[model samples]
Target chain A: MNKIEVCFSPELIHLHELQGKIVVVVDIFRATTTMVAALANGIEEISTFADLEECRRMKSQGFLIGGERNGQTVSGFDLGNSPVAFIKNEYSGQKLAMTTTNGTLAISKSANADEILIGAFPNLSATIAYIQKHRKDVLIHCAGWKGRFNLEDSLYAGALVKSLESSHEADEDGALAMKSLFEKEGHQLKGYLGQASHAKRLQNHGIEADIDFCLTLDLYDIVGKVENEKVKAVIKP
Target chain B: MNKIEVCFSPELIHLHELQGKIVVVVDIFRATTTMVAALANGIEEISTFADLEECRRMKSQGFLIGGERNGQTVSGFDLGNSPVAFIKNEYSGQKLAMTTTNGTLAISKSANADEILIGAFPNLSATIAYIQKHRKDVLIHCAGWKGRFNLEDSLYAGALVKSLESSHEADEDGALAMKSLFEKEGHQLKGYLGQASHAKRLQNHGIEADIDFCLTLDLYDIVGKVENEKVKAVIKP
Candidate 1:
């Protein structure tokens, strides 16, 4: 059986062997969810930057700039980190550049993986189907809130592990712990994850709708593949 | 109310602020469990060394040296990382120097905390009592297997958080996740943790008895406090 492991945060990524694994990078509160939403809505591609200034620089190169810091849109950016903003397909056919506190950093740090996939609740089924077809060792990387563990991303990781249970073995304790968490509380995703620190942080900023949207399951049948520092929606096999 | 946070691994310790907190370092599958057992049963003091050679070198100074690597005792050490060896109090009044794959390194990394306490199931009540008396922000540092997240240690952390919930707030997602884990599976610890990777590793080495012993709750009323690199049993206030 193939193995399924979880790296709780980007900081803990080094402890996991990524050389031959399919790394599913997830930032459930918004970043990865937004990427999936944007891609599914017909955005040309999504380029991620770890720095807000770098992401803004992409605006001059004809990319729509989206940046957030501590749950708010950066001044002068065209969009914030919200999946709802991308769902209308208003920015359809646009090339987007985005930066966030945690998500982009997670994708950047997962450069060593054999394959990198952007993961979120919206693309959950697509992700599971893709992994099942590939049959490689899988590592779910949660972009925790600023390198600290968060509930939503880890819960999503658990959701993925639970979904892939038939083909993949929960390889490590982190994966097993998350699988249990999802099994127990996943049905009440919104109410349960609302108690999360990041969720509360976003709620304080009046973004409760974004949290609910991010928790929506299988909203898009899209698989995002990270290549050349950009995440592009790929056709599922 | 004071905050109770769980740091899932020693590698993630840097993300937490430890300056004014009471840090509980745990390695449930034997290291911290052994320390609690040794200290509770009248071993005078236990000094933890991260290096096996350094721990072995303490033998010349009248210290009983114990060391383990990958679930087995070092060939020349006086004891292995098993609590059962210390339960008889054979090393009463003798100081011990020990090393292990993950435990000692966790203790060493936690030096920045205001106070460090060795924690395990056997001393669970004692640790809870100590934290109640101190009423400080608590950080449960789980010494995961070789800097990776382990179920046993994280479960112990959850148990600590659950016990302290009346007096302390679950401060982070990690803490809340662990607290939920303990509440859900804490009652059947042995059976639940028996499926843990570390527990399976020890069982493979023919140490099933030690796994059972380590999972025993409140077997000791001793609180091992880290002071100047030596863990001395302290009279609970």
Candidate 2:
């Protein structure tokens, strides 16, 4: 069994030390939530960019510009960080150029990982299945707010760890902490997650429904993987 | 009221942005714990260094070399990273050069902060008193285990946030999370910290008693501050 470890923040990872591990990118606050919802509702592949200029450059190449800043849609972008914005049927089969506060930052940081998978409560099962088949050491990359630790990301990581407990070891403190936190509140994710800073922020901003929606587990089986600058739905061989 | 933020991992700090804040360095695993214990037991001063060579040079200057690596005392060092070792009455009035896994790293990282104070449970009240007097803005730096997040550090941060909740705004996600965690377990720090990876490791290594000792609040009233490369006792004036 391969030992999977969870890193609570991207800064915890030394890229060179992770040469062979399969990395899971998690931004539960909204990025991965937005991604899963976009794909589950029929959007095509999503291309990511570390910088807004790069994402803008790709929009002319048949990509729909989408992303957010401080939880709102960028003025000219096609979509924002809201999962609600991603659910309209108009986006079916169109490529998305997505940028987010914490999610894209983490993706950019994990550019050198052997493989990257998007893990969110919405797509938990598919993510687990993919990891089990790959049989590679996994690193759960929590896209913390800016360079700091965020609770939503860590809770999602805890959920993943709880699901994959048989196949992974808690190598780092983040991993162990997640496991313990999970044991303490796994049965009531939404209640525990209510304490999350982003969740409270979103709620205070009058987006309480989004938090409820984001906490829905295994709502979609869509598996998104980063390949050549875009995250595509992986068709399992 | 000023906003107080606590970051358990140095990686969580955006040092460039924290230029004018009053920062507290907490490394309960050994560094801050030893600092508080030493000062309380009468060590005259404690100097910290990131480089072993600098520490070695100081040791030759009649300073006691006190530090550890991988949980063991460094070979040839006069003392290791144990709070017990620092509390020994035999070491009263001595000068010490210390280096450890996380605490010194945090101090070095705070090179740009307006001022830095060491926060450990033993000196929690004194640290809070220093914060009250210097209330420009406070950032607690949790010296995590070698650039990785450790539960004990975060819990210690929570203890600090719980102490100053009435006078500060929890600004960022990391700070808010620390505050939430503190509110949840500040009273049972040892029990709360028992779930951390470092605590488990220390427990497995038969040092659980040290973990308990380190979590005890207000054992000493000394505030440790790093000035001129040495951690010296400071009064709240």
Candidate 3:
């Protein structure tokens, strides 16, 4: 079996080190969560851009622009970084040029990875299934807040390790810590993360709904994989 | 009440933003723990430097040269990065120049902070006392492993918040998460961090004794303060 590793916040900074590994990009607070929901709810291919201008240029190419800034929708973009906005019927069979605060930046950093798959609670099972089938060393890349570690992202990483712990070995200390934290607190989401800084920030924003949406398990059977700077669903064999 | 923030890691990247905060540097695995233990056991002052050559130069200036690498004592040094080494009559009345994987880097980055104090479980109470007396906005900086977010450091940050919850306000999600984690598992050091990647790495290296030593509480009362590219103890009133 290929080794599966988890990269916490600091490891994510040197993301190029995982160039040879199959990568799973996770930003559960919004980016990956939105992507998982979009794909699961039947939206077609999503292209990502690091710069707003690049995404804007794609708008002229008939792509729907999607992204956000500091937790709010960017003006003139067709879709925001909200799961609700991404799950609409009108977005069906469409191309989405997406960007966000952290997740897209992570995807950009891991451009050298042999494969990049979006992982979130909603698509947890499908993501694990893909990892098992590939049997390649996996690098779980958490999109930390502003290139720093955040609570929600690390917890999601721990949650993933809990799902695939039987066959994977965590190479870094961060991976081991999150995995243990998960093993202890997997059953109690709110209680485990109630005093977390991000949870408080979310509560302050009155966006309790997003937090609930981000934590839903295995809601998406589809896998979001990156190809040519866009994330397209893999049609399961 | 000055704002109290938590820096998730000790990477140089965040140094630009932490320029004005009062930083509490935590490296429980060894560095800060060692510093606290050294001072509590009657070592006069601990001086820190990033480069070994500089430490040597400082030693020529009648200071003790001490440091470590990959959790082992540096070859030809006066001492290693363990608190156990500093607890002796040999270190009294002598200055010390030291470097380590994480703590030194954090102290260097914190050069711009209004003030910097070394913190760890070994001197948790004194650290809190220093911060309370200083009455400044504090930033708990976790000197993570090799520029990444290490769990032990975050846990230490949480431990601080857990101890001082009533007197502090967590301004960000990162702070709240750490406080929550600490509240949940701070007391049981081994139980809480036994599976951490670094701890496991140490166990693999037959250095398990250091983990227990690093986690001991109130072992020292010395406070480390930063001054012109080095850290030395501030004489308490």
Candidate 4:
């Protein structure tokens, strides 16, 4: 059987040997939520860059630039780490170049993976179906709060593990532990995330609405796949 | 109010900024379990070393040395990782020098902490009471499987956070998430840990007995303090 693993944080990326694995980049507090929202909202694709300068260069070439640092939008980007911002934007058939505290960095680091996909609550069922179709070893790469493990990302990883457990082996304790957490707290998503660090950080900035929106399950029935360094909607034919 | 935090793995040690924090080192499969069991069975003290050479030298000086690598006792050490092994060997009024794959390394890494105590399920309640009495910010540093996150340590850390919730604010979601995991799995430990990586590794080596004993709740009414570079019994004095 194929296996499921989790790199709990980007800082722990070195701890996982992800070669040839199918990877899902998750930044549930916003980045991944935005990616899924953009895809569902009909954005053409998203290019992830770890370097702000690279994202800036892409911006000059007509990419709608989205960047964030320490929970706020970059000084001049068209979008910050907000999914609702993506949903509201009039961006059809356009490229999104993204950089953020954790999400983009996690996506960028997964270059070695055989396949990479954007994941969040909104597109969760789609992501699972996609992985099951591929039937490859999977790694859920969580973009944590500034390289530290965050609750939202791990919780979503847990949800994925729970959905896939019948067909896939939990490669490590992380997979099992994460599934247990999601099972225990899956029902009270909004209430549970009220205690999350990143959620609280956003709440302090008065983006509690974003939390409620991002935690909305299966809002979009699509999976965003990374190909040629860009995340594009893998809408099944 | 003091804060409760968890370093889900030692790899995130830098993210912890452990200075001035009361740290409880946890390597639940064996090391911290052995430390508490040693104290419970009346071993005077233990000195943890990252270097096998240091432990070897201490052995020459008549310390009952314990060492492990890949779940087996190191050559020439007095004991391996099993809590039962320690309980069987009488070492009253003597010091133990220890080195292991994860636990001792975690202890050595926490040298900058304001105070360090060993934690495991066997000594859980006492460990909690000790921290409450001390009334300091706490970081539960999990000695994961070689700088990677492991299940048992994080679950025990969660148990600590859940028990201490009223008195201390959870500093991060790792703390809250950990507590939730503990609450969910605390009763079904054996069944839950049957899927854990380290537990399966041990079972492959036919040491499920160790896992069963290690998960036993508050089996010992003791707390082991790391003072003067050694872990000694803190018997309410």
Model 4 chain B poorest 10 in a row by lDDT: B85-94
User: What are the C-alpha RMSDs, in order, of all predicted structures?
Assistant: 1.7, 3.5, 3.1, 2.0
Query: Of models 1 and 4, which has the larger TM-score?
Result: 1
Report residue A54 deviation for candidate 3 (angstroms): 2.6
How does candidate 1 fare on TM-score?
Answer: 0.97
- When candidate 4 is compared with the true two-chain complex, its DockQ is 0.79
Q: Rank the candidates by DockQ, best first.
A: 4, 1, 2, 3
lDDT value, residue A185 of candidate 1: 89
lDDT of 3: 0.74
Off-target runs (Cα >4 Å) in candidate 3 are A1-4, A9-11, A69-76, A86-88, A183-208, B12-20, B69-75, B200-206, B228-230, B235-237
What tens-digit string does per-residue lDDT give for candidate 4 at B1-237?
989899977778887788888999999888889888887887788887788888889977878888787777889888886788767647767778888758877888888999999998888888889888888899999999988888988888888899999788886888988888989998888888777888888898888788999999877777888998889888932
lDDT of 1: 0.89
DockQ of each: 0.75, 0.40, 0.39, 0.79
The lDDT for every candidate, in the order shown, is: 0.89, 0.77, 0.74, 0.85
The model with the greatest TM-score is: 1
Strongest candidate by lDDT:
1
What are the per-residue Cα lDDT tens digits for candidate 2 across B28-103? 8767888888888888888887777678788778998876666777788888778887565678878988876467
Fill in the DockQ of model 1: 0.75
**How is the predicted docking of candidate 3 categorized under the CAPRI scheme?**
acceptable
Interface Cα RMSD, each model:
1.1, 3.5, 3.7, 1.1
